[model samples]
Target: METILKIENLTKDFGRIRALNNVSFTIEKGNVYGILGPNGSGKSTTLGIILNVVNKTSGNFTWFDGKTSTHDALKKVGAIIERPNFYPYMTAQQNLELVCKIKGISKNIIDEKLEAVNLLEWKNYKFSSYSLGMKQRLAIASALLNDPEILILDEPTNGLDPQGIHEIRSIIKKIAKTGTTILLASHLLDEVEKVCSHAVIIRKGVMLYAGPVDEMSATNGIIEAKTEEISLEELAVALEKSPQISSANVDFDKVVAKLNTEVSATEINKFLISQGIVVSYFEKRLPSLEQQFLELTNNK
Candidate 1:
């Protein structure tokens, strides 16, 4: 994969307070990369530095493909950091037109951008008349005005209803399908799991994990088992005695266990059978991005 951006030991400070601490990572072209962390974890600060909207007290970064922090490089990127600023009385089309004018894009691209975000029908609706979801789409439309190679969004789905979240997620998917690199900063774990191919998880102004989302999940293992005759208590005890089992818990009728290492489904099944326990069903649970996230952030 081609590298589109690289950060080497990037650091930022505000007097005595540090906003970022020696952060380093790379974003590849055509990838949906997520910056995930709790509030006050430097997610917004990191994006601001990358976009050159904030000054870094120390360290440096490079944008590839002839893109830098200069006007030439910034022109290749579009971003919405924090809440979007727009005229409340302006129609959606009018708002987008204003952005187009600012970016020096042809007026001909306004409708196309609105259509790209499925806002063409509502183009004439006042910004204040639009719902949170519609407003977010308009913000995205404004970002797309210049057909930027990369799109960076901070909390794109924040404060949205479930339906609105879904709408924005779908639009992001469609955009990524067109081969544009997307860098999203969000606290919503499920949204990142769904839309991002890779992620960088930060905490306390430090980078904790950065890599393919799938690979991060695969670092841990999960298993689910069901038994017809065995009591949940017995299942828990049985799992606790297994040398490979790292953690085990029973919920309702299911027994879920985390393993010290990846084990074959057949091996687990056989192990349960050899314990004189009838196995009704046994399967390995794939680790979710949520699970991986908790493991990374919650670790001491």
Candidate 2:
């Protein structure tokens, strides 16, 4: 795949505070890249610089095929930073029409963009009357007005209910399937895990980890086991002594063990039985993005 964006030694400052410090990464075409960090962690600041909405204190960035910032390169991108604003009196369609005019887009593309966000039916409804989800969909419609190849969204699901979150997530996935590269900036770990193919975790404006989501999850191994009325504490103590085990903890009725590497579930079961512990259920725990995020950011 081709590189869509690149940043080297990027730095931004706000008076005495450093917002981004020597942060660098590459975004590939046709992939959904997630930018994750805690509050005030510079995730939004980085996106702002990329969109040319904010200037960096130092360093350099290039976009689309590694071209330096230019009108031609920026024309291929679309973004919504923070909450989207619209005319409350105007309908969804009217609002999008206004966007089209600003972008010099032909009026014919209005319905096409609205349909991309599944808001075609609500296009005639007043923006003030639209629900939160509907407003978000319209925001997306505005971003898609130019049919950009690269899309950037910051906290796209913020303040949305469960169903609204689900709906917006589905729309994003569908857009990605069409070969549009997406950069999603969010603090929600679960949302990143569900939609992003790769991720870059930042903390205090520094890059902690950047790679495929699956590869990061595979680094920490976990095993869960349930025994037939056996003492979980005793089992944890025994597992901790095993050469393959890195750490062990007893949580309620389950014995959870962190392993040095991948191990077969059957091998664990047999080993426990040989030690006079009757195993009822056993399974390898898949590392969650949330757990990885907590470990990485907390350690920094």
Candidate 3:
């Protein structure tokens, strides 16, 4: 994979407070990368530094493999750090025309950009008349005006309803299919899990983990089992005594057990049957992103 952006030991400070502490990561081309953390965990600060909106106290970042000047490199990058404020009374088309003027870009591709964000039909609608979702879609269209090679979004789905979030995520997926690199900064774990191919998790200005999202899960297996013949407490006690399970407990109406990696769910089932426990339901579960996220942050 081609490297689009590289940060080496990047550190940032605001007076006595440190915003980022020797963070490093790489953004490869054609991957939707997510920067995830809690609200005050330096996600935005990192993005701001990379976009030259904030100054780094130490270390540096290279763009386009250092083949172009910072000014020229930024031309190929489109970013929306926060909810963009457009002229409320202006039509969507008129607002985009203004954006073109401000960015010194030609207004010829306004319709194409609008269509990309699925807002072409609403082009003539006044900005004030549009819903939060429509306004967000228009902001995306504005960012696409330059036909950038990379798109940087900060909390792209911040305050929208579930439907609006779905709309924006779909548009982002559509854009990713076109081979554009996307760098998303968000505190929403599920948003990153759904849209990002790779993720960098940060907490309290420290980098916790950075890699493929799938690799974040623990190696130990988890299983949920329910037995109708035996009490849930009985099942939990039996599983806890089994060598195949590290721990077992009654969770709600079911027995949730953490299995040893050396053993499989099949072994656990066979053992339960030997113990005269007939399970009504059984499932091997993969840990979710939220579960893994809580584990990572909570451990530190």
Among these predicted structures, which one has the highest lDDT?
3
Model 3 Cα RMSD, 1 decimal: 2.5
Candidate 2: stretches off by over 4 Å? 66-72, 217-220, 250-255
lDDT of 3 by residue, 123-196 (tens): 99899999988899999998889888899999999889999999899988888888899999898888887878
Top candidate, metric TM-score: 2
Query: What C-alpha RMSD separates each model from the true structure?
Result: 2.4, 2.2, 2.5
lDDT per residue (tens digit) for residues 172-198 in model 2: 888888889999999999988888999
Model 2: lDDT of residue 150: 90
- By descending TM-score, how would the candidates be arranged? 2, 1, 3
Q: What is residue 192's positional error in candidate 3, in angstroms? A: 1.4
Q: Report the Cα lDDT for residue 117, model 1.
A: 85
Q: Higher lDDT: candidate 1 or 3?
A: 3
Any residue pairs clashing in model 1, and if so which? none
Q: How many steric overlaps are in each model, in order?
A: 0, 0, 0
TM-score, each model?
A: 0.89, 0.91, 0.88
Error of 1 at 31 (Å): 1.4
